[model samples]
Target: MSRLLVTGGAGFIGSNFVHHVMEHSDDEVVVLDKMTYAGNAASLEGLPESRFTFVRGDICDRELVDRLVSGVDAVVHFAAESHNDNSLANPEPFITTNLYGTFALLEAVRKHDVRYHHISTDEVYGDLELDDPEKFHETTPYKPSSPYSASKAGSDLLVRAWARSFGVRATLSNCSNNYGPRQHVEKFIPRQITNVIDGIRPKLYGQGLNVRDWIHVDDHNAAVLLILERGEIGQTYLIGANGEQDNKTVIEKILTLMGQPADAYDHVNDRPGHDMRYAIDASRLREELGWEPTYKDFDAGLAATVEWYRANEGWWRPQKAAVEAKYAAQGQ
Candidate 1:
């Protein structure tokens, strides 16, 4: 069985990936997380002690990263300061964690010669116009608009450099928006879901015309595992489910599923530099790695996600007030 080191294992997508691996494979996982506000140790509770281990540490710590990389068979880099609004408010944390943090992990893996895979966002390719027929592809140029996307773009380059200059076995995948359980309420999908649950009106951003290519966390993680197992070294794959919907449609669906009127939500100010649309072209990943998404229906997957927040309010409750208050201060 393989032993994998998953950075950011206590956070949203990382935590879901950890659960996916535990349930679907025999591989053991050693999770290194800093317990950031977005990181929840409770999401990782109830795993088999023998197969799971959680380490509270920073990925920027080269010594600690080296010790962790020395033992694991592979390192899956998922740790990042991922909230765009926070990045706009303060960009330094994003630079330190996403860029320099990736450098530390690359150095460690290079020293130990371990398999590595870097997880990144499609925002590095920038936004598409509402009328454009194009979707982001493997060859898309980097045009990061926000501090968060810029940091990630820089990190992606670091992985490519390490693989070529040092011959470290590495692969990269850029995925579209992800929504599932254990996600922080600060995110778009969960915020609306929880807001409705608390008898609060759901808020939309500027006319809610922004479109996002949505994918379930399970689908995204499944593709990551596929690339790790069979993908060629130094290759990049794009993971998408073809689930594209505007903000208004998503909020309306959530309201309808929650037994409310479709127009029950309110519109608020949009975040600066908001992308108009983000679509992913996953032809390469499917043709090369034979990967396909199981959650093809956006509404069905979204309904299930809404139910998750409804049933697991205890898990998302503690952070709800703080998240809303932060948004309130920003007048978002």
Candidate 2:
């Protein structure tokens, strides 16, 4: 069985990857997570003890990273300061974690000669015009608009440089927006879902015309596994499911599926420097790796996500007040 060290494995995508690896392959997983506000230990509950282990630590810890890298056949780097709003408020953590933390992991993998995969977002390519038909691809020029995207952009460059200069066995994937079970309430989909669950009207950003290419977290992780296993080293793959929809339509879908009026949501001031659109062209991943998303229908995925929040209120409730409070403070 392949042994994997999954950084940020308690967070939404990483936890799902751990579960996916366990369920789909004969792999043992070691989860290295900092247990940030974004990472929840409970999300990783019920992993088979025989095949799974969780370590509470930061990816910035080079010694720990080296020790962990020594034991794993591969390292899937997912730890990052991911919230855009939080990054705008305080960019220090983003610089420290996204850049330096990635540096540490790269060094460890280079030293240990382990296979590595970096998870990134299409936000690194900045926004496209609402009418633009082009999507972010492997060769898209970097034009990050926010601290979060800039930091991620820098991280992706680091992986590329390490692969070429130091010959680190690494591949990278930049995925579009992801929505599914176990997502933190602060993210767009979960925020609206939890808000609706609390008898509060969902909040939409100004006009809600901004477009995002959404992909189910499971589909994203499935593609990640394919890349980690069979993708070309030093190559970049874009992971998308051709699920592009505007924010207005996504919110309305959530509301309608939740048995509420599509117009029940309220429009709030949009965040500063909000990207107008983010689209990903995953033709390389699909054609090269033969990957496909199981949740071909967005409505079906949103329905499942809504049910997850309804059934696991305890998992999201404790973080709800604080997340909304932070947003309220920002007047978002």
Candidate 3:
């Protein structure tokens, strides 16, 4: 059985991945998380004590990272300053965590020659025009439009360089937008879902014309596992499920699903450098690694996600007011 080190495993997608591994594999997982505002300890609750261990620590801590890296057979690097709005407000954390943290992990893995997988975002490709018929491919050129994306783009490059320069055993995957349970209220899908749950009108950015290629968090995690197992080192895979929907349509769907009027949402100021659309072409991952997303129906996934928040009010309620307050302050 493999012993895996999962950085940011307490955060949304990382936590989902931890659970996925527990449920599907014999792998023992060590979760290294900073317990930041986005990382919730409760999300990792009820994991088997024998198979799961949570380490509250920073990825930027080279000593702690080295110690952890030495004990695991593989390192799945997921820690990052992920929120675009927050990155716009403060870019320093993005640089520290996404860039420096990755460098630290790369150094540790290079020293030990451990198998490593880097988790990244499709935002590194910037955005495609709304009418553009193309999607982001593995060979797409980097054109990040925001601080968060730029920092992630920098981290991706670091992994590539480490793999080539030092011969670190590593692979990378850039996934599209993810939506599922345990997501923080600050994220787009969860923000809208929890706002409706709390009797607040959902807020949309500008005309809400920007589109995101959505995938279930479970599907994204599944792809990560497949890449880590079957993928060749020094390669990058794009993970997506072809679930694209505009913001307005998504918010309206949430409203209608929650028994509110279809038009019961507000259009607010848009954030600076908001990308118009993000689409992914995962043909390489699918064709090469035999990976495919099970959550193909977008509406079905949304309904299930809405149901999760409705049933887990205590989980999301604690962060609702503060998240909405921050957005309100930005006039978003």
Candidate 4:
């Protein structure tokens, strides 16, 4: 069995990936996360201690990273400050964690001679200007608009550079937006679910026209494993459900699923430089690795997600209150 290191393994996607990897393989996982406000250890609650190990640390610590990478067969880099609004409010943490921390992990992986899998986002391609939203391909140029996406773009480049310069076997997968269980409630989908349940208005921005391809976390996790196992070294793959839904549409869908009315939403000022759309082309992943998304229908998955929140208020209430308190203190 391969011993793997998963950075940011406590966050939403990372946490889901960890569960997916463990369930599908006999691998031992070492999760390195700082447990930042976004990174909560509770996500992995009740996981068998023998199958998983949690390390409270930052990816930027080169010494710790080197030691962690030394014995692992592979490393999956998933740690990042991923919110656009927060990135706009403060970009420094995004640069430091997303870019420099990624560099540190690359250095460690290079020294250890381990395979590296870098998880990335579709935002690196920036907003889509074309009328017909063709899926974003692996060859799409990096034209990130927000500080968050820009930082991720910089990290992606570093991964490529490390492979060319140091001969580190590395693969990349940029996926569309993900929603599933254990996601931090501050995200759009979860926020909407929680708000409607708590008798508050779901907030929308900019007419909610921004389009995103939604994928369930489980499907994204499966695609990541496919890339790690069958993807060509030094190649970039794009993973998606090909399920494109706009922000407003997604909110309305949630309302319908939760049996709430559309009038319950409160439209707010748009986020500055919000990407009008993000879509991904998964043709390469499908043709090359035979990886296909199973959760293409957002309604079922979204309804399940809302139910998860309803059933696990204890899991998210503290986190939700803390995040809200932080924003309230900032007068956001």
Off by over 4 Å in 3: none
Tens digit per residue, CA lDDT, model 2, 1-332: 89999999999999999999988999999999999999998899999999999999999998999999999999999999998888888999999999999999999999999999999999999999988878889999999999999999999999999999999999999999999999999999999999999999888989999999999999999999999999999999999998999999999999899899989988899988999999898999989999989999988888999999999999999999999998888777
Compared with the true structure, what per-residue lDDT tens digits does model 3 show for residues 95-134?
9999999999999999998999999999999999999999
Alpha-carbon local distance difference test for all models: 0.96, 0.94, 0.95, 0.89
TM-score of each: 0.99, 0.99, 0.99, 0.97
Candidate 4 residue lDDT tens string, 1-332: 99999999999999989989878999999999999988877888877789898999999999999999997999998999999889998999999999999999998888879999999999999868537646689888899999999999999999999999999899999999999998998898998888888877788886888888899999999999989998999999998987788889989988888888866687777778888888888999999899877776778888889899999898788877766666556543
lDDT winner between candidates 1 and 4 = 1
Per-model root-mean-square deviation over C-alphas: 0.6, 0.7, 0.6, 1.4
Q: How do these models rank on lDDT, best leading?
A: 1, 3, 2, 4
Give residue 277's lDDT in candidate 2 (0 to 100). 94
lDDT, candidate 4, equals 0.89
